[model samples]
Target chain A: MAVYHPDGPLILRLRAGDVDALGELYKRYKTSIYRTALAITRDQGAAEDILQESFLRLFTHAHRIRPDVPLHPWLYRVAVNLSYKWLRKQQKQQKATSDGVLEGLAASFHFLPEQWIERREAQEAIREAITQLPLGHRVVVVLFYLEELSLKEIAEILRIPEGTVKSRLHYARRFLRDTLEGRVPVGEIVYEFT
Target chain B: MSSRDLSSFDPLDRMVKEALQARFAGAEPSPRVWRRIRREAVRQGGRHRSRGIGDWAWFLLMARPTAPLVGRDEFPLGRFGLGMFLFPDAATLMTLRFGW
Candidate 1:
């Protein structure tokens, strides 16, 4: 039974006992998946764990599932669960860093003091608005804008109806627009992917 | 602006997308991912079962055996000890005197 991989042709090789296919899948989605994980976890280490665990699951199941089917949603499902587990584990392991202990003292330090006032203010304003969104709305926004999943696919990934995804997006857009008006600098909004 | 107004372009949408793209650029895989995943995969135990109904990893890893076999080396001849795993010497092969 030959099953072609969903996103890239490399996955097919994985089923044929080829390790190179696994490496290709890793490099292709690592950036976007890591970004999505980072957005949810808000910590680089936690996000890295999510990214790695998701791919590991992919490797383990490389021969079982239909390779032609999209793998990102399955990857997303694994990442989301792992992230929640990590968060729960954090509750049991509590040892605040020195940065947390002397945060008040460190607050007075002028780190990166040379940023243009308007540019820095605009960035802060955008971040504050995103942080203010309801968790569900924020996630939908991240999936749509960052991971670039379609609304239909987002609903499938979140296990909700498409209408609900659309509604949340509508509400999120309005909130962000109101919060960020007159703040974002005027020009083309460009993204230089690293 | 309505969806109609958004037909041409939308700054809010653009800004939101740009903001997310900028943040996503810094993501990467964790070092401890493999150990955790392999543990979970073993626990799952869903796929595989071809060679001998149980873990056939050794068989899969083993080299393929050459074909054709029929000799006094081994066979089910009436009971146990039909033939021992003994290599024939140069004189034994030239004369079949032991079989009778």
Candidate 2:
């Protein structure tokens, strides 16, 4: 019995100059890529852009990619790099804005309903906490938890050693645990992997 | 939060993962994103072809012989005279000078 490889045919078709193969690949992985980008960037527009850019990269580089290797890590690597670029750009813009002015603007921007405030606050807290993480730790956490990539795969995507990925993930979890100590209940938290 | 409190808590990885999943669940890229990608791909393809032509032109220019078509005497071997002291044999000197 021949095992079917979904990515194999699509990648081959893409290398053969079939644009529809690109679209097919997009349909298969867009949600996961977009969510990963959104998890890293915390911005809808930037996530959307990263998703498109990731697919575009796959399209352009299809000919050079080895068919024997899995394509998922390569795609995620591109998305992660683009997300970091977007985050760096956002940081630069934030730095350019005066702190006091930004604080005042943030204070005035609250318009959520009373009923939604708690939910929104919890969500915002998680997002803000993730954003506060150093980019290295943040990317590992996102890949491990959000994208459910194994340490080896994350290491491959990030082009780092597996030991580095493990340490980053360990530190990231510890940081988040400390940061959300009071907000998230101890019993509710679950460790997916040791 | 105290270190004891942090130590007592369950692993936060799952919670963070759940929060991310809940927040981004059902998220999809807008149609405009696909359109933009397609447009950019077309533009890049055109640019790649033009760049490829330019690369070939550059390669040909670099590959063209630098030596003049005139006699070997026209080109001074003095620039390579130091090589003669290291390799006194005529055949070896000729090979070094002509890069045969």
Candidate 3:
């Protein structure tokens, strides 16, 4: 409602005081943020939580927002960090379950659901192959392929080097190919589970 | 055949791309993220202003048009954004690279 350049400048001006801009921005990206969060965290509830927390962090750090600089990457970085924490927590919980218990628990969590049959088995196999990747590779693959973040953006989101992301993606691809083609056993894949 | 070309032509690489594309065959843009972000943006303003006068900077950032917009748009902006953020001009890197 305030008078200023109707282009991007006005958006920035309103952002200085107006709450409408916040609503407008949310209207734009809620799905990608939550979907990306869900793809990594693998929990719908956690994904929604991360979506809220990540945006909340963005609001808290708003002064750090550069009028001309990008926003999604920063928010992504926050969301990815939060998801990584959840992943780490899951790993710790799994580790605390003793040795063979993890495999059993994983079987329960990762196996075919009630509705799944032979056809679904094949689909599950594909996803399982992906889930079987080393944490690094899994993150890269999911973020790039499932969430559709580009290599460079993935780098920003993950706070890693472009070369590192590319290499991880490279290895993730080779590993997934082997897994899906049944050339490698799911348990044999060396995952950077940390 | 040259090694670079051979590596580039790797079936594994091709398969990965194929698999990913196949998985997300009907990938949609992230318009939904914008809606959620707007809600947090205002909630953020309230918290930041309540922090203290010294926290005015934090308040302004929540108010920035570019912040959440950046979050929703960054990945969607494609390879061009990738180059800018990941492989910025050396000068750009030099300036922003103090510490996280």
Candidate 4:
């Protein structure tokens, strides 16, 4: 008996140039991809563009895509590559405007005023720390935490050794721990990986 | 259990996850994204189809050998072939196709 795989049929349909299949895939993964881009770039407009370009590449390269495997990793690989490209160009052009955008992103969460006040400070500090990370470390942080992808999966997506992913994550977490320690009360910062 | 298992109930990981989730909770791309994607896809599809037709048209036009042809060296483009004529420079082609 053939095993059931959700993406197999969608990928086959996509290969046949069915835009609706692309749309279906987009509907399924848009939020995660968008959040990944948003977290990495810290720019809403650039994130949207990355999201659109990622799907468009999926559509255009459907013929080259293998239908046997899950499509999630490929989408992530493309999104991360595009985000890196944007970040490189952006670094050459302007400084990050994450303060206002991060504030807006946090504000969009409909929390009660008191809870918002309490959580907002910590969340903002955490987010700022994340944004301050080097892009390599930031990509790992986003993929690991935001997308909740496993280390093996992240290594595959980033096309890096698992040890490299672990190291980057280690570096990023330490940076965040140090940055957040004095700014916000994050309790105890443990180096579990050690 | 593997030494690489990251599921050891780490508080820092949990806090990072919560902070990320809270920051981007309910965040999504606007509807315009799909619209623009569709438009660009259609445009690219049309461009590919037209380029295919152009290639065939160039072939058919050349197959007859009705027109007098110049030497490959006399016409620098002749070395590159008529395909180069059908498609202009990359910059112009990109501008024409994508308006960028």
lDDT tens digits by residue: candidate 1, B5-91: 232255667666656666665656564554454455445552222312322443433434334553444434311221121222322
Over A15-126, each residue of candidate 3 has an lDDT whose tens digit, in order, gives: 4744454444555556666766676666766777788777666555555566565567776778777888888888888778765654664475444454543444545455
Every model's TM-score:
0.57, 0.67, 0.57, 0.69
Q: For model 3, what TM-score does chain A reach?
A: 0.75
Question: For model 4, what share of native contacts is present?
Answer: 0.42
User: How well does chain B match by TM-score in each candidate?
Assistant: 0.33, 0.32, 0.31, 0.36
Task: For candidate 3, write residues B1-100 as lDDT tens digits.
Answer: 1112223345444344344445444443354544565555655553122222333543543443555456655545543444344334432555579531
Ordered list by DockQ, greatest first: 4, 2, 1, 3
TM-score of the B chain in model 2? 0.32
Candidate 4 local lDDT, residue A173? 80
Q: Compose the digit string of candidate 2's lDDT tens values, residues B3-96.
A: 1223324545445666776787668888899788777776765122222232344454334335665346744453334334333464364788
Q: Largest lDDT belongs to which candidate?
A: 4
Q: On residues A1-194, what C-alpha lDDT tens digit does candidate 2 reach at each position?
A: 23256688778767776566677788888988998899888799899989988988898899877666667888999999999999988878878885464345434333333443365565665666777789988988777766777788888999998888877776777767676656654244354333
Local lDDT at B17 for model 1: 67
Segments of candidate 1 deviating more than 4 angstroms: A6-21, A84-117, A181-194, B1-8, B30-100
Task: Judge candidate 3 at residue B49 and give its lDDT.
Answer: 22
Residue pairs in collision within model 1: A5-A67
Across residues B44-100, which tens digit of lDDT does each residue of candidate 4 receive?
751223333433655643553323676444554453355445555543577679875
Q: How well does candidate 2 score on lDDT at residue A101?
A: 41
lDDT of 4 at A160: 95
Off by over 4 Å in 4: A1-4, A95-117, A189-191, B1-10, B46-100
DockQ of 1: 0.17
